[model samples]
Target: MTPASTDAKAIWRAFERTARADPGATALSTPGASVTREELATLASKIASAMRGAGVREHSVVTLMLPNSVEFVAAFLAVTQLPALAALVSTRYKASELRSIWAGIRPDAILVPPQHAAGVARLLDIERQHDMVVPGTDQVLRLLCVRSSGPASVLDVRERFGLRDPGSFPALFKFSSGATGTPKAVLWTAANVGAAAANVVETMGLDASDVVLAPVPLSHSYGFDLGILPLVFAGASLVIRDGFRPKTILTDLVDERISVFLGVPVMYRVLNRTRLDQVPDLSSVRYHVCSTAPLSVAQIEAFRRRFNAPIFQHYGSSETGGICLHVPSEIALRPGSVGRAMKNVGVSVVGTNGGALPAGCRGEVVISGEATAAGYVQGETVHDRNGFQDGFQDGCYRTGDVGFLDADGFLYLDGSRAGVVNVGGWKVSLAEVARVLESHPCVVESAVTAQTNPRRKQRVIAAVTLHDPAEEAELIAFCQARLADYKVPRRVHVLEQLPRAASGRVVLSADDLPS
Candidate 1:
């Protein structure tokens, strides 16, 4: 499809077209419930009607915090069908973390599980609330509308947040895992969302016959862009699992005849270690796509030996939907590379001068394509270095990833420009972890770094000089309270003094840190 064709397709409308074509086909399934294309569409329509009655309109922002269930899917579709932006928040986030993110997006409404309604109401100063039963499940969702001083208007919200007016209102809103201090809120226009889904369909060869099993959270960009979007654009079947259980996932792989599996490196690592009664034939599986973190050659080999399916590593960001994916046919030739750019996407390595570097020279990875987001939103300014150079339609995103393109155009990542460590699939900022540790009264200063373990991939390690005596577990527990579990250091070392250079900057390395 050309840019013009994709530009005309809205994400929700694309799903509607697919649903109309195959109304009886299974659109989504969970262990407890299932929904056909027609049923899911009708559910979304009903929810949209209810939202409209509650004063939701075009340009309104609705935050969704739910687990990976059919209700989450319907809520997302319902919001976008109204042409309102849907902001996805992880269900695992604590109230403190939620407040930090809400300060930027300032959602007009929030949809959460009934158990979380009281917490959300307290945070948003909700003026009205209602209990709504999810169509196909026993679950109940609490829809709360924030208190308003005057008439409901998107203009007031936009001005308050300092968001620019794109030609079209954005269809999706997401927050990055904080490259530095605070998480950055990003907005993607409907065209951008559609283009991303189209690119995945074209590149991954997805269709109505394929059944995908997604254990990852659909709220994440990895799952939303690849899992949900593909189901809508290609009319494929989706099997959702709330959490990962190796034995249960193994059984579902064969029971469901899943054709595609969306996962991360940590999942593959666990699966490799899981003992199966008997290895079942998984020939029905066409693609086992891994993203959110890098995969080691050993892990890839182990998976291929066990399942006879090669693991394809996908590389992208929340800002850019799907950049590079290791295609099945090219897996052997480009073993370590994240493969070439996805269809309709461009990837280049450029030096500081902004000129394209030679194939063998390492430089900043730049992306320009239909899948790139318009720009950062909420409190982030588009003029920053991370923002698009021109605009989403004709501009490029300077990805902070440091890598070089091979002579054959394959991309290999060396590292990121920022101080980030990948814990499982979640990106944890080293500076942020250090700050959390320093906040503890027992610590005078702290340094955090990433250490690679053969069994666990990458884990966060911290060293601290303490004014008061404290055990490593105590420090870790403190971090667990203040930060996300992934950001919490796996191990904490009590140090008398950290190695410093003449400039007084802590010079700490994983190798030099005490075990």
Candidate 2:
């Protein structure tokens, strides 16, 4: 596909082209059934017709609550046919979270599996609702359909979906993981959607023959860009599943002849620790991609030694599409580098003065590319008061990430700027402290934070989940040896697991830390 054809309309067009080329080819492979490209496209059109009947216009928002399945893909594609915004609500979220997001979005219609109909209505306090089932696929998907209540719009067209010029027509509405703070509603324009899909397909060298096994939620950016968008751009096959299951995933890798694996750090950590009686041959798997969170060197090494495949680290944000991916050839040499800027994407590290920092200097990571989103859903953009800045031809997004790029343009991340804590007068890096703690043989994962003492002083603290027996004092001592005394954790808490969001990102508040 050429740059000229990469537009929001290209997403649906590309899928249609692939279906026309080979309709019988399997596009989505689920545990229940396999959906051909033609079948899926037809399903999308059927759902689009239903949505149109429900007063879904060009700028309407259609919320999706289904899990990762053929139903979700078809519903999302259906939204694109109408050229409306698909506000993806993950089924993995709790009922309260669902209600909150639904209330904020106030979508014209929502699509869900049959079982959640009553619960969704009750939670969202909907007095009247109409449900229609789209038959096909299988028993589960046969009952999957859209529920339209014809809700009144709360916000105007521009404020609701962030629709502006023709190039900035909203396509997707997703919430950030809120790892650093409260989750914000993000809007991706049609151009952003087309460019995101194209960038990943081109950068990763994905093709129609590649079968991607994705256990991540399609509602999130990481899964959508790497899993579903590739299928739209390159005609690749998608093996979608709801949650992570290491053993079952291993079985599918061989049975399904998987080519690409998409996952987060937590899933990789569990898979690294999973004991297998006999390791299945994964020769068919070409790429093992990890995103959402950074992978420690220990994790990268462990997975490499166990599977003989290097874990390719993917770095990006919801506001910005794919910023960088690990260069396969340099993965071994630069163990922690997140690769140079992605194809057609420009990455720069800027200092506090907002000037681009020299190579090898750590600063805030700013991404400028065709794939970058317009801004948040409330009509913010690169030139607005938001973190985004306007300069590059396509505009730039301030990623709020702290990292440095080497002379060769390879990017290495330390952590987020918000991850820094002030203890006494010295500023301490929580990620550096956590890194030292996680490096200990017994620690599997760790989270570092700070708390204010009675004297109004910030106290650095840490928490760790260990694979073997270990004490808080030992972990604290371990960090003390590596980090400066001021940066060393004043206390360490031991836990079986840390609280994480649906995206597998460690979301910790000061209250979440043990006193």
Candidate 3:
């Protein structure tokens, strides 16, 4: 299909056709109940109607700070139906963080569950104060309090406004990695969303016959692209996991007959800790899709021993969706590999000076395709190339990750450019160091970071979680043997588990490290 025809309305029209053809098919299965495609459409229509009643129009931003419930999905689909833009944010965002996100967005309305309504109001107030604005000086932020029971939305479908004609305007805002309180909400157009969903369907082989398990938070881009958008576009059943409880998820996988399992590295590590005596019979799951963070060799081995399936590592970012993926026709994958580039996507490694690096040479990983977002959205400034390294040439978004492409075009990730630790004069990969530590027999997971030494030089530090108690000195020596002298961790902090963000990436903060 051509770019103009493959727009958001076209994707949404496909969904409407699916619902008409098979209204009885289950579209969403959550902790509460199952919603059929027919019922989902009805609810989305009601939400869309409500959005119009609330004065939401084309290009109006409606920020949703809700949980991974049916309501969240309804609001998002409604936005696309209205051809209006929306931003999904974490409900657990701190007040300051909320201020940062809301202040930048000129939202037409804000959606929140009743419990969080007060917080949202206060956050808006903070945003006004932070920006030195008076009442009615900015866009009127309408508050739509969503109910937790009965229906996904409060507005009645009978009070409906005609659906708007979908155009080239951005429809969704996908946030970058959760490290920053101030998020650079990456704008995604309907065309971008459709192209991304189609890419997943074509490359990952997702279809209506599959039931997907999503433990990743839907608010993040990884989950939106992998978990929500693809399922909605394909008219497939989605098992929405509210939280990552092993027992509940394990039971649901079998009960729901999940055919595709989407998870992250931390989730796999936690599942690896389950006793062999009580492992879930995940035979129904054909594809164990893992992304967001890199999987260590130990983790891969542990998953192999625990389950009969192979975890296909996915490589992408908020800037681009599903850059490289594992397909059935690809050559056998190597360790630490994230498969090859998807259809219509181009990935290359480039030096700091924007020159392309030869295959097998480490450098910044750049992506170009329909999957790449429109770039960061701030107040009055939608920097179309803010996330790119050099500039936006050929639709490429420079992924801050440091990686190398092999001879066969498979991508090998060492770590992120931002995650590198400088030790005196030498630079080392935090992921590389953690991979070596996690390889230890007693270790389950690990995270490495940069710390200031007494000499005021940057030193490498480590934090590890072990199945069995082990000496820190012994773990350090193990890394010393596998890594170069400068790359070895100068100090190790033995912890039960590393502090993690909602996305399951290890959180590197002063509190997470030793004094």
Give stretches of model 2 more than 4 Å off: 2-10, 94-104, 114-127, 137-166, 281-283, 379-394
The most accurate candidate by lDDT is: 1
Evaluate all candidate structures by whole-model CA lDDT and list the values in order. Answer: 0.77, 0.75, 0.70
Clashing pairs in 1: none
Supply the TM-score for candidate 2.
0.89
lDDT of 2 by residue, 455-513 (tens): 99998887888878998788877877888899988888888788776555777667887
Candidate 1 per-residue lDDT over residues 347-444, each given as its tens digit: 99999888999999988899988677767655433332244442233457887788899998899886566777678899887767876676675665
lDDT tens readout by residue for model 3, 1-515: 22345334554566677688789999988876788888888877767776666555555566877678677776677776775567888776677666666655555567776566666775443222111111212312235422212111212110111112233345677766434324566767667877888788777677789888887788877778778876677777888887788767777778888888888876787788766557765645877888877787567666766775577788877778888876533523475688889888988999988899998999988888876776666654455643342334456787778899989898988877778767777888888888888788778778777878568888788888887889989999898899999999888898876776544456765456768
Residue 391, candidate 3: Cα error in Å is: 5.9
Number of the top TM-score candidate: 2
RMSD of 1: 10.0
TM-score list, all predictions: 0.79, 0.89, 0.86
Q: What's the lDDT for residue 368 in model 3? A: 88
For residue 502, what is the lDDT in candidate 3?
A: 42
Cα deviation at 318, candidate 2, in Å, is: 0.8
The global Cα lDDT (0 to 1) of model 3 is 0.70
Off by over 4 Å in 1: 1-9, 149-166, 180-182, 380-394, 420-515
Worst-scoring 10-residue span by lDDT in model 1 = 1-10
- Order the candidates by lDDT, highest first — what do you get? 1, 2, 3
